[model samples]
Target: MNIGKTLFAQVMEFVPWKTFGRIIERHQGDAGVRTLGCADVFRVLAFAQLTWRESLRDIEACLAANQTKLFHMGIKAVPARSTLADALTQRDWRIYHALAQRLIARARALYAQEPSDLGLDATVYALDSTTIDLCLSLFDWAPFRSTKAAIKLHTLLDLRGAIPAFIHISDGKLHDVNVLDVLPVEAGAFYVMDRGYVDFARLYALHQAGAFFITRAKKGMDARRVYSAATDRSTGVICDQSIRFNGFYASRDYPEHLRRIRFKDPESGRTLIFLTNNTSLPALTIAALYKSRWQVELFFKWIKQHLRIKRFLGTSENAVKTQIWCAIATYVLIAIIKQELHLDASLYTCLQILSVSVFEKTQLSCALQPDRTQPELVSIANQLNLFEI
Candidate 1:
């Protein structure tokens, strides 16, 4: 019998530790560090995310339980609770952020060949934000309200594989629309967002950058129909027209003709008013593009439920950012593993199986494979006879 490393150790094989070490050196992440290094820090936090460990004590205990396997997992030593806590407080979080971006690029390349679900050949992305609430007493640095504190995770998710193409972490006070101003827009890409990001100025900026945007029109939006476009009611499209904003500020902000489509969702029976800058696509296609925005929401829900970002182990801002970035890195690593192995299992299922089996010796692919060798039942005897009744 082959006695191998834990399943968590197997997953860590996908991480480019040497490249990460180089990044740490470049950023001076481990300057004068005696016991705990940057790689060890990330490993501990990443272990917490994968195993759903709640506190520093939990992480220490788990690692201590598996102390003999630490070296196999690329951790030179099992760090104490205080040592790990100090590393989280002081280590440069940018190292993990850079690592996450690098992994994201790889994941994007792998999924780029996938056909768009919306049937469009262009690049499609869903833009949204999820606010993580924090306790104001412990986290006074992140001020959201008078009594509560929080941070917003602004993300741009590629619709192809539901992979995050971009992520921006900001204090909770930042508005969702403002996040658009800092995003580096790719020309010819279609960005689908909710009504919360319906700022004509930002949308116009996106248009000026040669990108298209799809968002829900606000309830009190004032617009004048410039041209009535043809539409089909069979697909739930009520009206398709080219319109210009009528409000003084709105007109000044976005002086271009915006395409408007009113549609009734066949699934929800709710009318949706869609606003977009691209006038070429079919009216039904525009509505479908907006519907794809829900993928980002699902991404948020999945991470929060599976990863340990919601209930933080540390109260410091640095620790919070470190954990969140590590969580994202773990997510990207899983994505890479899934794509590289071409596994058919859902990401949640893969995570759940890997959490406890990290110490198993089975190959990841073999473990994830469906059991197809089960013997088929030859025949079953009828327990109930209709004639007997």
Candidate 2:
């Protein structure tokens, strides 16, 4: 009988440890270490995320339980809760942040060839944010309101392969629209956002930078129509028109003509008013681009459910940021593995499989293979609603 490294070790093989070292050196992450080094800290945190460990004590208990295999897993010693807590609250979170960016670049390169069904070959992105609530007593500094504390995760997700191109962590008190000022706008790319991000000045900045934006129009928006374009009502497009802002600030912020479309959802029967800077694309295509914005919402839901972002390991700001960044890294690592191995299973399914088999001694790809011995029939009823009472 032959025993090998655990699935967790195999999965971590994709990380560029050498480049990771340069980031650590730049941050002085491991200026001095006696027992628990930065790598060990990362291994523990990544393990906690992958296995759904809820608290610091839970992580310590699990690592202690597997103490004999700690060296094999590249851990020098099992850290006590206090030691791990100190590391989480003191270590520079930029190491993991830079690492996540590196992984995002690799994932983007791998997904560069992915086809976009939105009828264009340009880079399309969805901008959105999710609020993670925290206990006011435990995290007083994150003050969302007089009674509540929380943090906001602003993410810009590329539609291709549902990959995150940018991520920013901010206080809950900060408005979503403010994130636009910091965004590195790429020329000729289209950004799809919700109504919460409507700021004429920022939108004008994007326009001046040669980028495009699509967002829902705010209620009572003052605009004067210049020309009306023909639209196909059969495709739910009510009307399309070229218009310019009439309000003093609105006009001064954006001096260019904008396009507005009135659309009605055939299924929901809900009417939607869309605003954009691009005038050439078909009305339906603009509507379709906005519809893709929901992908970022799905991505948020996925990470919150599968990863350990809700139940934090520590209460300090640095600890919270570090854990969240590690969670992002783990997510990107899985994406890289899925693409590199060409696994046919969905990402959620792959995460579920790896969760239970983290310690299994087998190649990650081999472990992910379809079982030939038992050909279980997938119920067609799940795919189709056979009957509704």
Candidate 3:
């Protein structure tokens, strides 16, 4: 961040605009138009997300009121509600998706060395999805039920630093299990999911890829125990066994042996059955990995509460995806800032400060800190003054 720039402009300085330009060129996002180019559209939508603007009209009115600061935010001009709406519908959503992924790569690297509670050295991820309800009449493209419509955000989150590594948006009719088919399998990584993704064939695929998985077993599963391993009862682990599927499909899909662990929670006294293929890790550690999957649920709740993905600005599919990806981009950008600046404030606090002080001409990093004392500015010969005397 530098002097003589709006806080919003300073916040956006972390983005790699040169890479963004290449992505725009590859996708032809700026083709045949000049007013709201790809970058400008992203900036305006990001502005809406950061400022909590609900509609295109609200964004238009706000930008109109703050006309002089639009240039600082990389918006060439104030777009009418209609133009912004059309731009949202017209621009390729993949452009924004690619940009979000680019930011994810950087964020993952920044948090790679983050410590894990499980004390495992291998990378671990949690998979889950959350549904957002919509109106059937307005969003006819996404048909969910007879009276209403909905969409799902299938996410794979890196537990380290709670960064989303992958996101897929689909209609509500899609089953949770289907997301596994398109998931990028990484060797030596551990994926923690729930029973909804317990297709034997798919789990076998992960096993063959040299990756590990921890998932809850369905009640009354059709598997026969081949061998039982020793377990310490005081640790809550009731039994650890090597099992083989008895059903025809399960047997055919996975001919190899599987490890199953039954553990009882001390407080609830309820037992849980967990299935996995990795035999090297301790049974308690595997159970703890399953327990950590709740982090993904917390992540979904966090984004839904803080971001603008719930009420959409456009009804078209492209428009919906655009809004979602921009929200994700804003999220990763904030995470990057938090890590780089070493700020003590929580994300919620940082967002609250940024939301109100976006256009404030002050030191952004200092203002976002938990301690908000103003810092003295030093003159820089290369920097031009906002107003020359």
Segments in model 2 whose C-alpha atoms lie over 4 Å from true places = 1-3, 372-389
> Considering only N, C-alpha and C atoms within 3 Å, which residue pairs clash in candidate 3?
none
- Each model's lDDT comes to 0.88, 0.89, 0.93
Off by over 4 Å in 3: 372-389
Model 1 C-alpha RMSD vs. true structure (Å) is 3.3
Candidate 1: tens digits of C-alpha lDDT, residues 1-389: 13476677778888987788788988999889898888888888888888889998998888889888888777887688888888889888898998888888889999999988777788999999999998999999999999899999999999998899999998899999998988989999999999999888889999999999999999989999999977788889999999998899999999989998999999989999999999889888888888889999998998888888889877888888888999999988998899999998878878888887777787788776557688987765856677895
Tell me how many clashing residue pairs each candidate has: 5, 0, 0
1-389 per-residue lDDT for model 2 (tens digits): 12488788887788889999999898889887666667677888888988889998998898898888777677778899989988988888888899999999999999889888975889999999999998999999898988889999999999998889999999899999999999989999999999999999999999999999999999999999999998779999998999999999999988989999999989899999999999889988998999989999999999999999998888989989999999998888888898999988778877888877787788788787656587778877557565855
Top of the candidates by TM-score: 3
What CA RMSD would candidate 2 show? 6.3
Against the hidden reference, what TM-scores do the models get? 0.94, 0.94, 0.94
